[model samples]
Target: MAGPGGWWGRKSTPAKVETYTRWSFYLIALSEPLVIGVTALGQVEARLALLFMVPVVGHVALALVLVSRALDWTAGRRPQPLGLLGAVGAATAVLAVTSLVLTQHGPDGEGAETVLGAVFGTTVTYGVGMMALAMKERRRVVWLVAGYGVGAGLVASALGVPAVAALSMAAFMTAASGFIAATSCFSVWLLNAVYALDEARETRARLAVAEERLRFGRDLHDVMGRNLAVIALKSELAVQLARRDRPEAVEQMIEVQRIAQESQREVREVVRGYRRADLEAELSGARGVLRAAGIDCEVSGETDGLPAEVQSALGWVVREATTNVLRHGDAKRCTVTVRRPEGRVVLTVRNDGATAPHGSSRAGGTGLAGLRERLSDVGGTLDAGEAGDGEFRLVAEVPLTARPALEVVS
Candidate 1:
């Protein structure tokens, strides 16, 4: 079995919100029986209290079922609970009529009237509120609440209640139900907003990856497109010349070979540039991307004097760490620090979210393994793992030494 907090800790932000909202409605449904049923027992005769308890308990049960189904419908997990919604509405009407009958003939005391009034108002308020959650439009929610309030008054007046008292009941029901309706609607809205934001964050990460791929593709095309066309034309001309036994055909073929060799070198340069990361640029980008994703990212380091190879390796570390923070965990804050301690330049990135394990494959990609390979090339070391207190930390260390710069082909 999982530990005490494991169940809750495993749930995502939106799932937590959904659970909280669903249980809030459940609590309201449960409170109906505890508040109204218990009040009925103490304030009225046993038989009459039982009469009131019957409908109150029944309504609470039906409300619980409807709340689940309605929320499921709202989340698109299931079809609309049209049948359940109608049943709950019918139960609410029955509860209201029962309360009115008891108030009219079953009792003649202040306590009895108070309990019956509580039953009538509370039932209608919660019932309307619960139904409002499944409604697609605010206008329908308004109409539903108004209709119930007006219906309450009409039912009271038809049962011979005083006109002024019936009007007061209508107003009370309308205002109370309106408050509950607004609360329910707001809860649903907040839950949806949370889910939408999480999805948008994922989309942003995907878009960033796509944009980087497009950049690489464009660079490759620019490097190879012209060279490949020239090589093809030269080869075709050489073929025609060689068939005519022209001496220039040998020269043209040699030129084509040189062009092909140059193309190969250029392609390697493009790949090298694409693979290499600038430490300063990566640091700045990591901060911006994390901050845009609602993470508080703090960078406290300089990359000015680092060797190119060391910087490139550490820069990959920063990029990968930032991506993990964005895609793997629910991190709130990230801290990146670079320190040169005598012989080694140490880069550390720590985040408050620790869901992703160290060296884990990321979305079918090499993940930390790729980072490890990059760091190894520069004679650096990488360490990534949970650092306790719900934090994940990645540390890369490269020796501070002069490294030969990559030679460019002339």
Candidate 2:
């Protein structure tokens, strides 16, 4: 996944910027030890240099082993805390013993640079140890760092080194140690935070898809539920009449076929996301459904010679309004009126016995919001609100132009 266009994907602008930052951290980690190693080698003979390298290599190896677990934790891998603890303890012990040995084996007349080089070698052990301790126990880590700096200063002072020099080294090492440790810990924590956010975003996307599926299921049930029931009733009647006269059975069977065909068309419309309404079909369906539900429904309209865009937009308004009347309120009467005046086509649906919408906002349901979006694209508008005492009204208007229809069709 490290290769090009793999897990990192095609490197974006942000990723390219981070490349320099990532390299800077690595260079600092590597150069700290190298600077100390090179400075020690220049000041000492080959024999002493070899001896010096032994403890430096050992301490750094142990520190690296200890910090590897923290790296693993950042990468969302298992943290071997027990092994990390062992490595940290071993590194600290080795660095302490090495510092005491360096003090005893004073560099040919106590050269300050050589002694400081040996002391600087302890940085890796202290830095990695501090990070481990900080992650586990904050208070204890502060005291541990303080004790390490003081102990190193005491060791240098006991070797009869200058008081001022020992104190300076102690302060310098302490600051350097804290800087490396804090940087490493913070970098890992930031990466982990980014990973968590990505997971949360993916989870939300999945939940949204699930919500859409549930919405589609509800709409399908609403559309086909009554139609299927009517088909069942008609088929039963057709079977009974077939036993007596064939012509009556034939008529009932034809009605069942028509209902089934309409249901299939409605299902297709819901699935394809191209659900433009037909004025005649919507008007016919709404009247039939409303009357069957025992509500006195009256529709007044001149739907002839209208542009396709106007018909599609207003047809959706009629259909949604009728659906709301059936599903939402307890109504005795509903009126649908369509008029074309002054180059505007207006369709109004108003009903008595209006109840509060099932949800908070009027456009909370997908149907109304979708209708509004559809209307907007075709230079049209929609408004739904309480009209008067115990009544709600929905009004939709569209420009009478063939341009919108062309745009919608294309």
Candidate 3:
């Protein structure tokens, strides 16, 4: 019923009145076999003329409806792909029907039946093809819908589908349509779900980093604050006592200054560990810890000329290895080597011996996991275990040109 005036009166997106409008060609396409079957009962001489009456009634009504729907879609600015499907489907159905009617000599004849059947058969084939070629697996339900279409064509050809049989078949087809439509709609749903989850995860990650930064700042304040206050008080007391007890006060004041300077450096490096990796500071820290623990620490190889990324990652490896030696090794000494071989950076941390059960290795810990993740982003890696007789070692290699700070330090 949509005319020039009527088509202008609707809004778009979630298009209204598409149920009947989109399907009008389907009714035309469905009735092709019916008209041919009906013509089969008529006389040969007048059959063509009578068949013309069916086209004017059934075919023309069907075509007008489809065209009007296309116009409505265009006016409403329907999506290009859906609009294309509607246009193509309508055109194909019209062509198929026209060809069948023109090729027919008369009613009740073999040639006429063959032509009409082929027209419907081709449509069924196309529907099946679309379903088969659909990108998503669930969309294959279009096969069942296409099968139903073929069955409907067969039933309509007889011009005598019982009401009960027609209803049953229609119900089956509608169910299949639901499945196909659901498959299409699921893609949109999945995309939205993935997008929402990604945003949530990113938010959580940011929160975790913020929380860790806060914790680090608090720990630094607590540890260094008390130590610095003690050092300051000792220095003041030593200065007052220096006027009388010169020898004892001189030693105390020297000790106080040394302790205060070391503590201040430690605090600066701890702050850097939270926000950055400072190579020279980390190396100095490692040297201090191992040397204090009665282990002779040797740092060798050229470290001064390395890129920032290589230096930083190697610095982490040094930190973790020193931490391990302190916690587990009862070694006399540890040799730390940084080597650049064939344009790649390598770090080796070797301890003489460990005070632990024989023939066992710790599976992994957070420090190791953190190192691995950092290395992996830059196409680098860590390999750690016993490397020689009675010696434990950790080795890390990174590309000199790698940009881990840009890629991973986030």
Candidate 4:
């Protein structure tokens, strides 16, 4: 359990979801203005059009900055941009409202309504931009957003635009409020979901590592525990016999030495066996490991009557393939098949979600190259490439015509 000192941790990034929401906000920023421009085409005076452009552009820049910072925060990046852009956007929104109010001739006319309509529409976009920054900063600023919304609504009302109407400037502003709520709240919810997923994945990886370590420790204890105990007891007995000056004491001592030597040899054999690769054992292990990693693995093969050399070579291939599947790709299903048709043993590992391996060339890292070398020693060939539709296939074929000399494993 974590201690009290570490109970409440700092906030983190939203990762995968940040990119999506940022792009969504970008689309909103791009489209909202175009929409308002179309709606106010004939009503706005030419002299005051440039004033409107400033706030729109400023608000978009501010929103982009917010989403970009949010992305950086989630990804654990450093040196984020300063937060002054939101302040600038807020000031620009004030200017826009002032300009719209000054230009209005009367409260109920088409020209007055159009300017107020554009002002109110973009005010909602500005509110969204502020809410985004608050979320990125992980601060309690909903009250600030609420206050800003009220202020914008009041500005609209001053020019004969109500906050709520069935088919007027008030209605569009009301929709803007809804838009702000949906985007802000949805982005937050999605961020939390993404964070939870990342946490679960990390937990799974840590558990797998811990389980492997425990298994190795248990195996070592089983292999050497009893042998060491027997050696200790025998040495004590031999010492007592030697103190009594009996000739049998020497024999006892010699027997103890022989037993110690045998135990040493046994330990070496045990360690070597633990390290050596066996095809059947590799297949079984691969299945268990893949299943533990939430991947469905189906293996089909006949292991009987195979040359030991071929099995060992193919075992390495299976081991390497399993590691790559777990570490490199986001695979969900893996199929391993072994066939001995036409006097040659063919082993194929096919898996979905295989990405192109990164590094020099496409043949993958040094591990596959080593496997290729091992296979070649037994008249075998290895081929690996994409099988289309996001599938990766690896095939290792070794001829059975020439029986390979058994290779000693140390």
Per-prediction backbone clash count:
0, 0, 0, 1
lDDT of 1 by residue, 1-410 (tens): 96745566566777778999999999987887788876766677788777767878888888898889888887789998888889988889888888888888866898889889889888999999988888879999999999999999999999999999999989999999999999998998998898898889888888988998999999989989999999999999999999999999999999999999999888888878887889999999999999988999999977788877888888888888887787667789999999989988999998887555423523324788888777666677777776778777778888887353454544
Model 4, range 214-282, lDDT digits (tens) per residue?
A: 876787787668777877887788788878876777877687788767777776666555445689989
- Output candidate 3 Cα RMSD: 20.2
Q: How does model 2 score by TM-score?
A: 0.54
Task: Identify the candidate with maximal TM-score.
Answer: 1
Model 1 is weakest, by summed lDDT over 10 consecutive residues, at: 356-365
Rank the models by TM-score, top first.
Answer: 1, 4, 2, 3
Q: Write the per-residue lDDT of candidate 3 for residues 260-314, one digit (tens) a residue.
A: 7788777766755664565667778889867875789998887888777777777
Q: What is the lDDT of residue 311 in candidate 3?
A: 73
Positional deviation of 290 in candidate 4, in angstroms? 6.2
Give the CA lDDT, 0 to 100, for residue 22 in model 2.
Answer: 50
lDDT of 3: 0.57
Query: What TM-score quantifies how close candidate 4 is to the native fold?
Result: 0.71
